[model samples]
Target: MQNKKRLMRVLGGGALYAATFFFDFDNEILNIAMFLLGYFIIGGDIVWKAVKNILRGQVFDENFLMFIATIGAFAIGDYEEAVGVMLFFQVGELFQSYAVDQSRKSIAGLMDIRPDYANLRRGSEIVKVDPDEVMVGDEIIVKTGEKIPLDAIVIEGESMVDTSSLTGESVPREVTVGSELLSGCVNINGVLTARVTKEFGDSTVSKILDLVENASNKKSNSENFITKFARYYTPGVVILAVLLAVVPPLMYSDQEFTKWLVRALTFLVISCPCALVISIPLSFFGGIGGASKLGVLVKGSNYLEALAQTEIVVFDKTGTLTKGVFNVQEIHSEVMSREELIELTAYAENYSNHPISLSLKRAYGKAIDNAAITNVKELPGHGVQAFVHGKEVLAGNYKLMKKMKIAYFKGEIMGTVVHVAVGGEYVGYIVIADEIKNDAAIAIQDLKTEKVKQTVMLTGDSKSIGEHVAKKLGLDKAYTELLPADKVEKLEELFAKKTEKGKLVFVGDGVNDAPVLARADIGIAMGGVGSDAAIEAADVVIMTDEPSKIATAIRASKKTLSIVKQNIVFALGVKGIVLVLGAMGIANMWTAVFADVGVSVIAILNAMRVLNTQSIHNSTVPAWEGNVEALSNA
Candidate 1:
């Protein structure tokens, strides 16, 4: 609506300026009055803003520059040029406003995840209330097509949720009983009853919204430089413009005051600095918005700027590169078939609640019959022994086999091995380990391609497991058996190794990783499965839990910085040439208007390009599942 009004004013002023041009009134006073009317219609706000700023001791800004230059043109009796320059300037301001709004909307659209209302369930009665009013442990009902209002754990029903708003992935996620449901996801196809786990203020949606809203508060080095440049640059240019108008005309008897005054006004118009001041920050803003679309949330432009200089990338093993959940990897059987061996072992360990036991049960893929098992005995440091269908069965580590005097072959494998012994005879062993994420290898390789100096992994897992994963992922370095404090200490050492201009990025998802995450130059947390502490400590959060997004974030930061540099150089270079030309009386008010407004519009258009993530989005492969070694070598 505001833009419409501005557009109308521009059109009205433009028509009047055309009338004065084509059908000039013979009387100079009548022609000047018509031009003044047109000028006030288009640039009245600029004049008002200049007056208000001058009263407030903020004497030199774009508003002041435009006001002084165009008013001088009118004073020189170049009425058409004065009103025409103001008209073009107003058009530029309108374009700038529209560009900024579009950039803001691109970011705002990503944060459209905030739920307005939550359906609270109260013993057969359902009430709709604001999301803030929903408390933890309260039961909430989410119907199909409604957003999950708060972070919750599903208590009943099954459905597919559209997580694209949060994760930027269009594929719907399946949520069933006991599944953790984050706020902002749309429940697509079922009515779900869920127990809220966090209050609205602490919910995922709120935190993300708060993060994005506050992102602009932190400024990058380029933005700070531009601010300081404009502060001193504007006043300096104003003084120089004043001297150009006054001293040159007084010093030379041949030079007329009006000619020097017109050149001075042109100089002032070209000196606006709107291009650099506006486009640089706009570029960073667009980059952050683009990253959010790729499921990477940059906390601020400062972190986004630092990301471009990232030299070292450190990773946590569990919940980062690997799926935190353990799964059976391989089954080696001698006497029994793979299925029979796993089934018997699953029955023996069915009653236990260990992760290995759960993995065994999951591998079995059938309901366990407790009636078939009898007299189960658990060895605290070893394993479990139970009777399955009257046959003596044991499923444990090598210690259990040694303790039972059973001859077992201990295979060389980089995982937790569960050996099985049936009636004092060695059957086989099953290997269970945390599986690496589908994109883990790709993430590591892409970081290297981004010119990262080192790709390192820090884990509390055993040396063998860590080394195996590091080798499989083709990481440059691996430090295993490190405690939380040890990871921080190691990060400090790595920090010292980087150049002063380079930054270190640490990625983790566990609570223990919070300290190291906070200690690093930049911390990236996997928001989907990340602990609250880790996420809070992180500078960047990957909402989709993909390690590859780290590379995507770096790519975005570099592109944004490149755009900023281009704007600065281009704005300065063009303005410098035009300022010199205007001072020499070779350039007119029209050239000055183009230098200030045309450059700004073009730079803004270039900045807007950062918001288009299609090229960046399409660059990533689905999942690099080939040989990590071959890719690393390549």
Candidate 2:
């Protein structure tokens, strides 16, 4: 409704101004009244704002510039120039507002993931209530096509959940009993009853919304420079215009005061700085909105700027380049049978909850008698030491065997090796290996195609396993057998190796990786729905857990920065040439209006190109080769 009213006023004032050129009124009073009506109709709000700002001692703004320049034109009997300047300025403002609205719609689409209400189970009946009113541990029923209101664990039903809004993956994930469901996913095709694990305030959707809403407060260096430039540029130009009007006519006897004053008015109209002030930040805003559509959330524009300068990308082994889930692959026994070796190893690691230990228990497939196991001690950075069947058993790495003075044979296997010792003597070892993610090899290839100089992997796994995965993925370097603290030290070394202007990006998905993630120049967290520590520590969050999105993010950042540079160069270059011409009396007020308002509209249109994410993503990745055998082997 407000837009309609403003549009009507602009059209009405524009029609009155156009009529003055076609029809001449015989009476001077009538001609002056028509000019006054059009000028005040188009620029009355600007004049009122200028007065208000002057009273509050906040006078040097766009409104003040337009008010003084147009009123000075009217004082010199250039009534048509006065009305045209204000009319074109309003048209430029409408275009800027429309461009900003379009950018905001992209962000508002993501905000639609917030659920309106939850269906809480009460006794024998289900009642609808606000999501915030539902407490933790309450059972919630999600019907088909309803948004899951809270993070929960499925307890009684099977279904498929659409996770596109949260993860940007189009395929629906199958969920059964014991499967974890995150908030903001839509339950599809089944009735599911889940026990809520978190309250509304701590849910996944709330955190994402909070992160996006506060993102604009953290500005980039370019944005800060433009802001400070505008702060001083307006007042400096006003002072220069005062000198161009007063000092030039007084110094030269032949110079007319009115002609010099007209040039000064044209200069004020040209030096608004609206083009630089609006389009630079809009470019970054569109870039962030574009990234969200690809399931990559940048917490601020500063991180986006750093991502564009990335030269080295470091990846974590587990849950980043490869699936973190472990599987038992091979077992070698020295003296005891394979069955006996497996039974003793499982018993020694019974009390542990590591992925390797769990894989051993799963392979054993039998419950151990906890009464027989005694004196279980866990040794960090090595392995576990426990007494099984009245004999001391050791299940750990080669370091543990060397510490106990037990001679062990090393196996040439491309996996993590768990060495076993019985009564201080070498027995056997088990090989546990993790499968690489389907997109892991392609993700590395895509990074290289994007011109990333170095791709490195850091892992706590054995040297053989690390080198195998790194070689398979075609990484530049691989460092293995690193502890949590050792990972930080290695990162510091890599940091010094980079060029002075180049940046290093670290990607991780575990709690142990928080230190290295924080230490890098840009930290990216994978699987934001799963790890709170990763989300808290990372500057960028990949919601889908796909390493390919890293390439997508870098592509988007480079495009956004490219647009920003284009706007800065175009706006300044045009204004510089036109300002010189206006001062030399070669250009008029009409040319000044085009220099200020027309350039702003064009730059805003250019900035809006960042919101086209389909084009960005399509350009980032190449067409997939249909070689299934090669992909699986990789």
Q: Candidate 2 on 131-164: residue-level lDDT in tens?
A: 9999999999999999999999999999999998
Runs in model 2 deviating more than 4 A are 19-23, 331-352, 361-410, 418-430, 618-634
lDDT of predicted model 2: 0.87
lDDT for residue 414 in candidate 1, whole number 0-100: 73
With a 3 Å backbone cut-off (N, CA, C), the pairs that clash in candidate 1 are: none
TM-scores of all candidate predictions against the true structure: 0.92, 0.88
lDDT by residue for model 1 over 3-122, one digit each (tens)? Answer: 999999999888988888699599978988999999999898899999999999998888999999998888888888999899999999899889889888888897799898999998
The number of the candidate with the highest TM-score is 1
Q: Which ten residues in a row have the lowest lDDT in candidate 2?
A: 624-633
Clashes of each: 0, 0
Tell me the spans in candidate 1 whose CA falls farther than 4 Å from its real position. 333-344, 347-351, 368-381, 384-395, 400-407, 421-427, 527-531, 618-623, 626-634
Per-residue error at 57 for model 1, in Å? 1.7
